[model samples]
Target: MASKQDTAAQGTPVSGGTASQHTTPPKPSADAEDAAKDKKPGTVSIDQDVEDKDHQLPPHPEPLPPQHPSFIHCMPPKNPAITKNKHSVFLAGSIEMGNAVQWQPHMVKRLHHLPITVCNPRRGHWNTSIIPAKDDMDFKTQVEWELKALDDVTVVCFFFDHNTRSPVTMLELGLLAEKHKVVVCCDKRFWKSGNIHIVCGKYGIPYCETFEGLVGLIMKELKKNDLDVDENGKLLSEPSSAD
Candidate 1:
């Protein structure tokens, strides 16, 4: 009964209206749908929460193997045969009784992986009360043992601890300086570092300021003598001859 224009103006459905006469709601965008999926209970997408497997970190590597111990020869009373084929190092340094640091054990540990012998003069059971005189047989024997070991070893390694005077070490340095087989390491704080440095420079001996540097210099000397090895104690391969 209502006119068509009046029915449309009053917001009422027109009589026998076609489907095309009404508006259709828009479809959700792809991004909105994805966001809705991620918001679902117990559901998480890679972009929203989970990290991609391709970008994940790698597993840790295995640790290196343990090193082998070197042959060590301590000073007199307990005579052990020296390894003839292996190179030897004589630890001649600050042994100011209770005053000096026990550096020999550390040095021996550093060179443990190498095929070498270490001549350690610091006795495990030294008679500290013995008078250091020619008349004292014990003193004479100890001094004689050091002298022979210093003379026989492949290299003489010296470390001047800053805490002690080490006059005997200085004397030993002077004795071996001209031999070109000596390597010296002196703490910068040592009282006589200047004198040691000058002597090393004059004799063309390798001088370093730290214990580790002394070890490196010793390795270099060994390498020069055909005992080739890397810093990690791995033996270096010999270069093949050209046909």
Candidate 2:
């Protein structure tokens, strides 16, 4: 049998009784205890679940895919599909053929995260020779599609480009002003800025001078009506009792 001094030197607990006797494990060192306490809170270890009961922390949510807004344009002779969305925006702005800036693409990019449909009037292939006559089937179809989309959408965003006259845009604004579903962005450089300003003021319509400001106003309107969505395309707020 080994001497008690030999057993102690080998770091084994010594027992005077039979070998069947059990020995208690040694306590952890002070340094080890302090190190454990110093560990960052909420740091999940391999042995611990992400949602540890002792920590009372929720599991980290997985990242959601990017959300893109649906777009509808006047062409291919289709009905206003924008009505399929919970909310829609009619891009009633300056599209003076080859003259006005292509602002629709920029607007669409900015509103990509929202769960709303964007109805664009600019045709993909416009025939300049097509006469705007009542008998012209193509012209009639385009006008009818725009009219229906304007009526079906929740908001009408009107942008008066400084480069073009935008007579049609002005007319559309007048038609929707009384309905109180229009927002205007009139560039100060626009020839008819004064008239647009006066009309917007008269109807108490929200109007802005910059493109960014226009987007902000539209977001505000959507949030006010609970029609806006989160980054994951989920509705930001629950529908009101009236809705």
Candidate 3:
């Protein structure tokens, strides 16, 4: 009984008024979409099935966790004549390089000539995820070595890279700032450098901007300790004319 004009008026799609044409629902935000797409733990996720094209197996070896390592315990073998001389120059700084560690070798390369040994924390076993109850040898070794290295070092150098969040390094600096011969090199762009600089000034802990400058300060410390560093940065039994 309805007229063509009536039917046309009722069925014709208007600007956001008629339901004749298919109207797509509003899309969700990225976060909402991700939440919906993610398979929460303990939930039945259709995507988890191996037959599902979306399901992918993890790598053969799971990645390791963050490590707070110690190197003082690991000493390389040397000839008896080498004279395993003075204690270590504890390298305390950022070691988190994701899958690999940095900072230690670079510092060692620079300070290798110094009479003191390098007490590097990164040189030891570095699996931090391992529980102590089942396997505590690594934990015990690092803790003991660090305690010894902390006390025995003639000088401690704290190097802060702007990219690293070094909470432990800060603690080490605070502990040794007034108690020991310590030097700090904090990049100006680092979030905590201002606080460190102020602390260094307040406590009279020598501070510098560059790693090379830290080396210069280390040279000065070596001089005070009756040792000398060469122009090429090799530790010398006595002063050289190059100085």
**TM-score for all models, in order of appearance:** 0.67, 0.65, 0.58
Q: Residue 111 lDDT in model 3?
A: 51
Candidate 1 clashing pairs?
A: none
Candidate 3 global CA lDDT score: 0.49
lDDT of 1 at 32: 30
Estimate the overall C-alpha local distance difference test score of candidate 1: 0.59
Find the candidate with the highest lDDT and give its number: 1
Summarize candidate 3's per-residue lDDT along 1-243 as a digit string, tens digits: 101111111111112111122211123323223434653444332111122121111111112222212212222111111124443476677644221223444455445444455665543223445344525775566556665666767677877766668887888888887764777767575689889888887877777655545665666665566665553344555432221
Ranking by TM-score: 1, 2, 3
Pick the TM-score winner: 1
Off by over 4 Å in 2: 1-65, 69-76, 228-243
The reply for model 3, stretches above 4 Å from the true place, is 1-83, 97-101, 131-137, 230-243
Residues 141-170 of candidate 1 have per-residue lDDT tens digits of 888888888887778888887777999999
User: How far does residue 188 in candidate 2 sit from its true spot (Å)?
Assistant: 1.5
Task: Tell me how far the alpha carbon of residue 76 in candidate 1 is from the true structure, in angstroms, after superposition.
Answer: 2.8
lDDT of 3 at 90: 69
Q: For residues 1-243, could you state the per-residue lDDT of candidate 2 as single tens digits?
A: 111211111111122221222222123223223434644544322111121112111111234234443433322245666645666788888876634555564465455556677777754445555688989987898888889888988888888777679999999989888876778777666799888878887877887665544665666566655765542234565443222
